[model samples]
Target: MLRVAAVKSPKIKKIENSPPASPPPSPVQLARAEENRIIALAKLHQSRTQGLFVNVGPSWMKVLEPEIKKEYFQSLCKFIASERSKHTIYPPTDEVFSWTRMCTLNEVRLLILIQFLFFSVGLCFSVKPGVQRPPSLANMYQELSKDIPEFKSPDHGCLTGWASQGVLLLNACLTVRASQANSHKDKGWEKLTDAVIKWLNSNRSGLVFILWGAYAQKKGSFIDQKKHCVLKGVHPSPLSAHRGFFGCHHFSKCNDYLVQQNKKPIDWNMLPAELMKENINIQN
Candidate 1:
């Protein structure tokens, strides 16, 4: 045997294990998400007015009825003052006061009762529009939750609970004339709504949606139904509610959907009505 080549073989290096690279989003998904993002940004922030882009829905404008008597609003001013004096409580946000003026006492009461209930809300309509207000009623979000819990006596509480729960309260039409229901019919509200839908489809998934009417259900097709909970029923109004809304038990149903998704159930209860009596406006 030739001893001329006794050099040690070069040591072999072992390759360390590493995480596999994540696959890139498919072209379809990428295209969809990007397209959605662009549409959402434009929808929420941009508009075409008289062939020019106008900042319509995103930055709310308060166009109070120029025709209504000052006394109608003055009544609200008085009511607001009375509430403040009676409970030493005031609307937490300017929106609280403004929407309260638009809402009935029962509506406000219902608004406060959704605290311990569903963690999300889906709406068929925007609350209202005004010169200084966004086309949506998202501003009164906080005050709506100051009063109720999800478990018992759940109410709409100015939709504050839904607002707090990050609900998507959308409207096909963004601008409604104060006294006219169809004033904004031709104002391109449908396009604005499409933008919101695209934004939702792109930005989030596995959410709970409340589709309480034909109009709401119509929008359902736009959402990612595969990844979200879509709850449907009649509109929450006396006219159609008898068709389904009353016994829908949507609050509990919504919470149930949340739990199924491995989410913490909405903290439907606030302090017992007696404990927070002072700050609450519902105490008799």
Candidate 2:
């Protein structure tokens, strides 16, 4: 015990010589940072809201990225908190519901793209889910066809035009209408007619214009000149038969002309054969 040497004291570094380390950001701090970024972007541009449809932005897309899933969470919060969340665009019908499920499972982006495109063009705008049309486009279509006996066929309506084609389809329809508009005054019939004609004149060629019914026929003069071929005569309404609008042979003639010009056969048989037969029978 007496032989023990004095223990040497450990050298300690002076506090002034020590290096400082950065502090970690708290969760609250990180969340606030993200919110600030999103808010700043939202201020730069606000998307338009149609009935039930919400136009998502690139920021929203970024938020959905798996790495930055926080953005998605924030977007969901914003969307759900917004008044538009309560709306429903689809019907209760099992068929439409089933289609919606299928679209969700397969082509969510495609469906959203379509709605966005439609909103941009000002046609068939979406409403909030579950919100019914006051006069409803369907009701309006029914009313419009009420007096037109030829439009008695289930498929012979405006809604059919909306349902059968993509959002861009209406553009084709409108183009056909515009090419025929001789003057600004002719634009008075309906905005859609004017839009169609304008679109057609700008994008000519490779477009097939179907001019059904007397109204379309009367206004189809310009389209007749511009299109590869215009299928004219009665509107495929059942009344077309009694009105002598069908069996003009223009349908087949136009199809054949298109084949000759384009070096390809026109598939006028896109619709069900039975529907085609019904149209032909009514016309005859």
Candidate 3:
């Protein structure tokens, strides 16, 4: 038996008082950690989904410090937010799929530009990725060209073919709410719209701008009339279709302009083929 020290050593006192090293996170703690991981992954997937055509937030969000990452994640989530998630507005990372406004090797003269307020329907992507247009917009596309005037979920191939052949579907506001009612009302939208218009107007000309309705027509004001063909009319909404939209003969007129410009007319029929039959690329 060791003799008791007149006074306990400071070392012994420290050891006894320090308290047992906190046990490794409890089973409960481990479970909570796993749950957090799952949540993080889900949030990332949502961001990527909303991004469309481009892999925006998900891929890189992991590397940022927690605070900064939260900022962007919250921003991107705003467009897709439900009543619970809406917060600060953030710029979108993806674009609706399309070729550059200035495409070369086109079998045509210049791109036919169709302007919209914003993407009325969210762009859908899959392993075989593509965009899904709203019903009215789809009808507008069919009216422009094609025999069958309908498709369920339009694919990327349709858009790719149009871009490849010679069409630029430009939206005045590039990003909008997932909800249609308040779609492009946010303050950031017009700033984005101005940038896109400026880009199109800069170092480009002779583009055919199809400005349907008052809003799209207004968006075209900055585009030089000397450089582009501004085809304006009532919008393609069911409400406005009767207001000089039906039988406006825009498709034929667009082709006519292209032909007059000495550039090959776009194969409007191509989109119909690609949209209805996903496996095929639209040709002639």
Candidate 4:
């Protein structure tokens, strides 16, 4: 057997140029990227300027014009920043003033307009000094429960239940100086709140107003009585809850009005299941 020797041909190796070095980004491309970044920042500023913060929920914001919203947000931030520099403010500058949690602002059927919110309490209606007296809010809750038997009391200090039931707990003067009531009064909150009430009155119908104090009643006075229901009572503070707030069947009457208006009555008894356990734990 003869073995044939095979001659291997010299293979030419082709050197491939590396992917053209990805052509260093053109000046135009870089400029475009910078422009995009500027545009993105501008959008973010516009959102904040338009009061798109979650705490300033869209429901209320939608009622006011965008210009009004922008002015209000900027002015409020300016005032808060200035006041905070001088002394301690009740609601820290960082926290958004709304105490509401589960509210879907568009769905709100009732408005609870208050004069001024308490300072840093977390729970807006949680009255203090439990040993000396029962929490006035709790007393009011009892009255509500008496009328709507299934109404779950916010014993856990969470207003999620009330908020979920479409009750908006709004304060006219959202900020106050610590230990000094009405310190922030006439600082433009009046104008903003007035606008909100007037807007709602004109645009929406079949809504209910629970004006708990003289101030709140006065604020809601312009509300069209024929188109909506207005329930006025003394302030629910321990000092005044006894005078008229106790006997006023506002809860039941609110539902009655809703029924008459052909709108679904709020299930005052409905509370989220998750919050139920939280309520129990807080009690224990």
Candidate 5:
């Protein structure tokens, strides 16, 4: 009983605390993201490669007909043989069969046949110019001259029916070629359109597409028309300015639009008054 009366319990204070925060994303999460990015890149590359084969392969095959006859088959055989000496890179069954097939074809006969067919058509046209007439070469040249006035020689005053300025501008600024009726047949055009679309998708930027003629207008429809600002007009024939293809008052408005956007003008030397006014507006 000596000090029991004065003994007292120590007071305890409860420490208030916040819950533990989640740890930063672990190394595993970072590695997974990297893996996904690599897979995406691989898929994109595969898609591009397949697209190239589908659009361009047949045209390339036709163009390479000569090379195929002379050296391609033999070269493939040699490469396969070389690869076989090392560990097999290609399937053995497929390689052996393909090599055997290549060696059996009569290359010389095929070449002669193609050459004969080409010359025979030339001979037939020359012999029967009237009854079996395809368009005359001279008439064809004349029509082309009309379509492209720049073809007029210096001695020729203006080539009677041709429109000079419009043809010149069109040729200089835009290339219009005869494409196959089937859009799929124009591989170069397809590839260019595909690339532009891909770039736009990735960049999320606005694009302006200028279509100069009916043909181009039709082709533009195949693309993602909504994604870009498309400006369509006639073929820029000399008549276009008078007919108000886009607008007579602003014949060169497209050029002005481009310049204001910090883009290059279609033709700097031929800047119309409307374009100059736009330029002044931009400066002010």
Candidate 6:
């Protein structure tokens, strides 16, 4: 064996020039990064509002039930974020996923679900989740008040008042573009809302569900009619409200069912004391 000297390779110095500034992120990549950021923010919003929300939407939102913290809700939030960043148009208060927090979670005896955030009126007036005074809502208040007399008419503060009485007001499709109906349909919101409905039907007993319109009624099909009361009616939209919504009497019917179930009836006349007084005076 001939002795051979091994040549050592020269050591090259490492050069780090800030990694080319990441190529300034291509348009597609910038778009993707933005999408990821949106998703992260949406997820963060969900996390921050979890377990008895710490100031998410309004005073009402702060007291939302623990449902907001569930896995289904988190998944929905991520999907919504991703979808919105891609193409879906979100409504005004993207943070308020559902109109929950009428009362403690356990106190909820009824769930009211509509198809989507009916934004027909939202284009004209800013919709502040718990404070929206759309014509449809006003019609509901009017009709229900006419029937029950105690159910207060729609005023500036009546929306929150109604929510504070333990009715979980939810929309199957949570968001849509302004003036566009069901624009956000099939965008993964149904799963979350459906899960909420199913959870209530299974875990809780003697609950009342008011499923307005064909879409909500369809989504509510899985509810066990044997365990809960499911009330179906035409949506209270101006287009079809005259067809059946006017006489649906869902408010009284919901209260009646609650009584039958031995649950305290939701006082549909949920106006604050002062507002109630003013309302009465106006009527007088």
The best candidate in terms of TM-score:
4
Residues 1-284 of candidate 1 have per-residue lDDT tens digits of 86796889899999998999999999778766755554465353223111112222211122222211234333433443454444432112222222222322221111211101111112222222221222222212221233223334322233334333334344454333334454435334354345545544555555676665576677556677786777766665545545655556666666677778766555544312111111111111
Best by lDDT: 4
Alpha-carbon deviation at 263 in model 3, angstroms: 2.0
Candidate number that wins on lDDT, 3 or 6: 6
lDDT per residue as tens, model 6, 26-81 = 77776666555544544565566332122222222222334556666566556555
Supply the TM-score for candidate 4.
0.68
RMSD of each: 16.7, 17.3, 16.0, 12.1, 20.4, 15.8
Better of 1 and 2 by lDDT: 1
Candidate 1 has its poorest 10 consecutive residues by lDDT at: 112-121
Error of 3 at 120 (Å): 7.9
Q: In what order do the candidates fall by TM-score, top score first? A: 4, 6, 3, 1, 2, 5
10 residues in a row with least lDDT, candidate 4: 275-284
* Candidate no. 6 TM-score: 0.63
Clashes of 6: 0
**Model 6, which residues run further than 4 Å from truth?**
1-79, 82-94, 119-132, 272-284
Number of colliding residue pairs in model 3: 1
- lDDT winner between candidates 4 and 5: 4
**Total clashing residue pairs per candidate?**
28, 19, 1, 0, 0, 0
**In model 5, which residue pairs have backbone atoms overlapping below 3 Å?**
none
Kindly list the per-residue Cα lDDT of model 2 for residues 176-248, writing each as its tens digit.
1122222212212133333434444444454445555555555545553554455554443344433543335
